[model samples]
Target chain A: MQETPRIRMLLGLADDALIHGHRLSEWTGHAPTLEEELALANIALDLIGQARALYQATGLPEDDLAYLRDPHQFRNVLIAELPNGDFAFTIARLLLVATAADLAWRDAATSDDSDLPAIAAMARNEIAYHIRHAADWLIRLGDGTEESHRRSQNALDALWPYTGELTVGIDRSAWLGAIEAVLERATLTHPADGWMQGGGRDGRHTEHLGHLLAEMQILPRSHPGATW
Target chain B: MTNTPLWEVFVRARNGLAHKHVGSVHAADATMALQAARDVYTRRGEGLSLWVVPSNAIVASDPTDREMLFEPTGSKIYRHPTFYEVPEEVGHM
Candidate 1:
């Protein structure tokens, strides 16, 4: 399909939500504690819900778009597709992505040319909670014991390169301020700026996205007519 | 799971109602505990507001003394307001 800019932007956001939500859902039976499991699952559900809205705005059934997309067709930033390393790594990535998402959705909600203001509006509310949840976890992990602090710092350093790709529908400075404030409170040093990565929006992604898509689309592709 | 403390969660369903003890969550601190409470208890919109406290901080009555304390109050008919014979004009009182 030859998508207009608006529809493309919507699909990109939808991809981000769906892929990141899937990553979070991977923690379903594996989180360290029951409460943490519930928390991650709840946030995952919220992201997937946002994905559904954006997919609908593109005039396609959400399941079809989500379950049938090829790796090259997905437009989620590489950051969202990265493996959840450790608990600290998960929190660090979520803090960055949720902050960026909050900014992106806030801008999309008020844009005069937006076709679905309501989708962005609801997304803003959901991302607000996601930002807080991720920030709190990051702070505790970063400022915590020797092992946790080291892990948090390492995750931030590793994930810093992909933060550049999040500016698709938002300003870097606006979102960076929020991320830096949380880093300051977390007592974690922000990684010095260096080479930045991009191209996901144009369908170029890391090897991780391919593996992720295969795992995500397997059931749907394998059993085309399967139903509950 | 790294020896995180447990917290007791209370949720108020609406304004003008007291927060009722709903459940518990494990968190490293109060903020995480409160956020966890929101995720664990209010996902279905069951709460209007929430409070989370360290589970150890709560001073619960000893269950072993239940027979000596609550059982005494249960049989005290004098504590019953129904003992009073009021005229119909007294209304709810």
Candidate 2:
């Protein structure tokens, strides 16, 4: 409820995980295969778990923060709110965000000996797995077939602009290098950097966040204090 | 579904423990099989290590040979380690 520099940082982390996890959850019943269905769901759960911990660290009720926030109140980066395009697109998106999340959480865990650091320590391990899963898929799709290569490359280029917002407290060069190595291994060309889009960090966001929140918040808003 | 082969999974609960057969996962390669096994079988820290083998690679005993192959072994009680005298210090093998 109260805004502080530290709380805003926590919100940024929580919102990114929450929105990205929500987007991933959309693939629950529709992933390409049974193994991928389970894999994607597990990754989504890990991300939501990370969001829960970060929100809890803010000393606000995590549910209230999640379900009661307005569209403008969300601080998740723009790339996270984008729709899951195709299988290759989702994997590409995962590769990008998971890499950033892994680095960000690692830095946070090592930054201080506080409650946020403890949450970050646990989150860092889970996100390490996310990074590996995404990287593995990126390679498979990027190098697998002619169609897959085109799709994977397109996904990276499309999502590249929104990544500019992720570097507020993150190391841009480290993130870029890590991503570049994976892209190189995947045999996917790196998109040229250009006019980087931003905003969600300062509460400005794409139109998608409103629709996402509308669906995500409806049950809580409609029912108020009711619980099963 | 397109040539993604099935692999049988085995997971070790901890160091010094055997990797018991867990289940199967479908993957295009050995590396993906391991990742799939980790995702499907070991979500709750249930394993210290994992192994995935192509399901087709495993050779299984024929059910019809059970009596011929295993019946004699059932009668061979002398193979049991119970024949050895245990020193008290050795304790609980």
Candidate 3:
């Protein structure tokens, strides 16, 4: 049987959340401050929760989708799987992705598909905070001391090229406008439009994804059928 | 930085109730304090409302003065509501 567009879309959303949530979880003990550690962990939990809901909607066990799939089989955006280089880099990626997610889920909340609207409704709320938190950090880091300002600008420049891939089918203007507003408030100059990268949606990913999956799937693959 | 101020967090578990102290978190400002409080103290839906007050803003009495502040009230039994018994029919009182 062929996969329905609905299932494919749901899988994409689930993969995005799961991969990004895994990245965010890496900051658990490593955030700059104790408060930030908790904040990141909470956001990670929210994303993972969204992924689980999205997966469950497809009538598949979330663990199987998360832990059993090979890297090439996953449907997340390349940006979601990118290595978090530094605090500023993570914030930059997070701000971009959260903005897209906030907009995506906002529309999904009204989806006609089964379970998606309800799942999206709850996810929309969590992603709203994720946007707020990321935007807050963006502003603070972008407008803060010289070192912070430089790092924030550099992070944006490095990550900006990957953002074009995020708006392939979705309405790009709204996401662009929202991001521009945040950038303006942060006193940061937007990077010039340049070459864009794609292919994560097509099952093509960067080298980092393989390493991420290796760590994420190690236990599950090593001990198949093992129950906690 | 370590010098960031700490804010005490309080949560009102439900409507028509007072906020009770839950914990504290370090924040550079009140907005971040509230955000941290929400992230740290309310993850389990344990609050209907939140209050974040800077630790420095609080004027707590010295613990050493507890005897002078509270012990004297203990012997003032007349101030107690249990001093007088209600009739058996007044079950609630």
Model 1 interface CAPRI class? medium
Over A1-228, each residue of candidate 3 has an lDDT whose tens digit, in order, gives 235787788888999999999999999788999888889999999999999999999887778888998888888999999988899889889999999988788778787888988998888888889989889888988988899889999988988888887876677899889999998988887777789988888789999999999999999899998898
Give the TM-scores of the predictions, in the order they appear. Answer: 0.92, 0.92, 0.95
Worst 10 residues of 2 chain A by lDDT: A107-116
Writing each residue's lDDT as its tens digit, candidate 3 over B1-93 gives 898899999999999999999989998888888988998888899999999998989998999999999999988888878877789998884
Candidate 3: give the clashing pairs: none
DockQ of 1: 0.78
Better-scoring candidate (DockQ), 1 or 2? 1
Cα lDDT of model 1 by residue, B1-93, tens digit: 768899999999999999999989988788888888988899898999999989899898999989987888877888878886899998895
DockQ of 3: 0.78
Q: lDDT tens digits, residues A21-77, model 1?
A: 999999999998888899999989999998988898898777788888788888889
Cα lDDT tens digits, model 2, A1-228, are: 788988898999999999999999999899888888889999899889989988888889999999999988898999999989999889988988888887887888777736778888788788888889999889988998999999999998898888788776788899999998998989998777789998898888889899999999999999998799
Reference-based lDDT, residue A207, model 2 = 90
Chain A accuracy as TM-score for every candidate: 0.96, 0.97, 0.96
Q: Model 1: residues >4 Å from true position, as ranges?
A: B81-93
RMSD of 3: 1.5
Q: Please rank every candidate by lDDT, starting with the best.
A: 2, 3, 1
Residue B45 lDDT in candidate 2: 88
